[model samples]
Target: MKYSKIFQYAYIVFAVLFIYDAISKYMSNGDIYYPSILLAALAIFIFFFRKRFSKKFDNRDNSK
Candidate 1:
């Protein structure tokens, strides 16, 4: 599989795990802080992956 597809699948798994964690936390403790923090972290992970891939592709295109 391509690296991009691998990244995409990883993102999906991370998202699913994050959602499940958030829901479990909410149900167990009724606190929003931890879940919010986890969500923010997941967002950062996605953003980083996006930027990294974009840069990689951009550089490749520019060099050609």
Candidate 2:
């Protein structure tokens, strides 16, 4: 099951952004909040859905 490189990169970017946001939020409040959890969930969800999401887009964009 091959996946698109764009999807892979999107996951990486989402992870990094989430991590940064989580850390910033935690540092500002000295505790984890909903945003951090949400970001983490977003990262995980993106990873889990990468293949499916990419396939959908790929099929939709078929040039033929």
- The per-model lDDT (C-alpha) reads 0.72, 0.73
Model 1 residue 49 lDDT score: 84
Top candidate when judged by TM-score against the true structure: 1
lDDT of 2 by residue, 1-64 (tens): 3436666667767777877887897898887767756876777777768767776878888955
The 10 consecutive residues of candidate 1 with the worst lDDT sum are 1-10
Query: Clashes in model 2: which pairs?
Result: none
lDDT of 1 by residue, 1-64 (tens): 2676567567656766777777777789997657655775776688678867777987998999
Runs of candidate 1 exceeding 4 Å displacement:
35-64
Tell me how candidate 2 scores on lDDT: 0.73
Per-candidate TM-score against the hidden true structure = 0.52, 0.50
